[model samples]
Target: MRYLTGYSEAVRAQMQAIHARQGLGRLLLARYPAPHGMRTDRALHAFVTELKTEHLRRAPPIDKVLYDSKLQVVQHALGLHTAISRKQGARLKASREIRIASVFKDVPHDFLQMIVVHELAHLKERDHDRAFYQLCESMEPRYHQLELDLRLYLTHLEATGERLWSGSGSSGAHAGADPQPAAGGRL
Candidate 1:
């Protein structure tokens, strides 16, 4: 699948077999049955801030954290971390923001956490190098497994156009919602 380009042919074939049997969604649901109820932008901001506080306390502060409908999963931009500069009188201020794709709003908590951990890692290591992955793993012990599962979820979505999780507290209510105002804070 396009989402699994980095995986080996054998792994891809295994995934294909799972898809052939329509077990992708079942496998994911068995692993993660519930969604983490951080639905609103305010909630997302708090969730991200807590993680940042616990892991990267010395890194640059995050000015905003919200679900962005503009991010397309096909492009591999599940989440983004940006530093925006502004001129506050004579001094230039840099504001860091993290935007997660709306599709993640309906996924498992571990999937969302993996994406946030990746973006949070950017606060220190800018590139996707060894140090960046090390930071991600430090923040979440199951980082790699969650990432692979997320990719599998994306592959299943791209193939069937069906969502495995959808209901109250886990629906797509905020999937295309507008970006809320910055939840300004420093940890």
Candidate 2:
């Protein structure tokens, strides 16, 4: 219920629909395949970089991108986009960075794309205004849907304490709510 909290009635209804589907017969995630070939930070960077090159060509380049273990989805922050600016002597040096919750490592690629695009959009737009959302939509056409479905995925995780897609692999990995991998990540 906490995971489903903060959502509107319509979204909660949608989540119930998905939950019913998950319960009546099979897990809803079965219908959505997990992302493959991106289990490591390096692979994830390459994936994000490709997306950046494709849509946000003129946006500021990302200085750092990593799967942060400290990013807990329970706090409602699936991803973070930050510009660390510090003045050294007379010039201000800033680095744009993106941090994705490690919980997403096992989610579907659509969900991952949604979060990544959301963060990437921050490079150009600081606020979640019209232009910010427009940029998110431009990067990921199904941004809203994927976000809702991702919420459903989190709700499922909360209710069942099962990760539909586990770290070992989608086929054989047993479900575990916490799949905390290593701390240090490759760029």
Per-residue lDDT of candidate 1, residues 59-156 (tens digit): 98999999987676333477888999999999999999999888778878998898899889999998777787788889998877777777778767
lDDT of 2 by residue, 1-187 (tens): 3444545666566557767666511444555755555778888889899999999899888888898766663434778888999899999999888888887788778878888888888888887777877788788777766655565666666666677767452222122222221111111
Clash number by candidate, in order? 0, 0
Question: What TM-score does structure 2 among the candidates reach?
Answer: 0.78
Model 2 worst lDDT window (10 residues): 178-187
Error of 2 at 177 (Å): 18
RMSD of each: 8.1, 8.3
Q: How far in Å is the alpha carbon of 155 misplaced in model 1?
A: 0.4
Quantify how close model 1 is to the true structure by its C-alpha RMSD in Å. Answer: 8.1
lDDT score, candidate 1, position 81: 88
